[model samples]
Target: MSGVDAFPGKGKVAHCDKEKFDLKKELARVTRERDILKKALGYFAKQKE
Candidate 1:
């Protein structure tokens, strides 16, 4: 009763934690790609001048 038996919602908590981890990983990847696209856009914008 002192271990996992004390928390019946531990499974749900673990699932949420895993989902959060995956979201954060995807966010990082999207952010990196966005930055690259921004840089490319800037390069092309300068060509018009």
Candidate 2:
């Protein structure tokens, strides 16, 4: 009834599911990259100071 499922059509539902899955994967990748960057930044900051 709400959020990525407003459409009742079969194709739409499938697309929504795929999109949700893709988003989850992308989120995980981005989170990992962000964590790596934070660690690198901290390392550089420590080296600089």
Candidate 3:
């Protein structure tokens, strides 16, 4: 009925799903790195004080 259905049997859906998963993984890694940097900054600030 829709454009997606028109291309049935193609791996378009699978590709999108994979892309979404990759983006989520990247976001999680970046978030973890940010948290670590924040903690390091806090520690240095305390040392300076």
- The best candidate in terms of TM-score: 3
lDDT of candidate 1 vs native? Answer: 0.90
- Model 1 regions more than 4 Å off: 1-13
Better structure of 1 and 2 per lDDT: 1
Candidate 2, residues 2-40, lDDT tens digits: the string is 867876565545777889999999999999999999999
What digit string (tens of lDDT, one per residue) describes model 1 on residues 1-49?
7886787763565877889999999999999999999999999999998
Where does candidate 2 stray beyond 4 Å? 1-13
Candidate scoring better on lDDT of 2 and 3? 3
**Candidate 3: residue 11 lDDT (0-100):** 52
Of 2 and 3, which scores higher on TM-score?
A: 3
In model 3, pairs of residues that clash are: none
Across residues 8-40, which tens digit of lDDT does each residue of candidate 3 receive?
775556878889999999999999999999999
- Give candidate 1's TM-score: 0.69
Q: What value of lDDT does candidate 3 attain over all alpha carbons?
A: 0.91
Cα TM-score of candidate 3 = 0.72
RMSD of each: 4.2, 5.8, 4.0
Question: Against the correct fold, how does model 2 do in TM-score?
Answer: 0.71
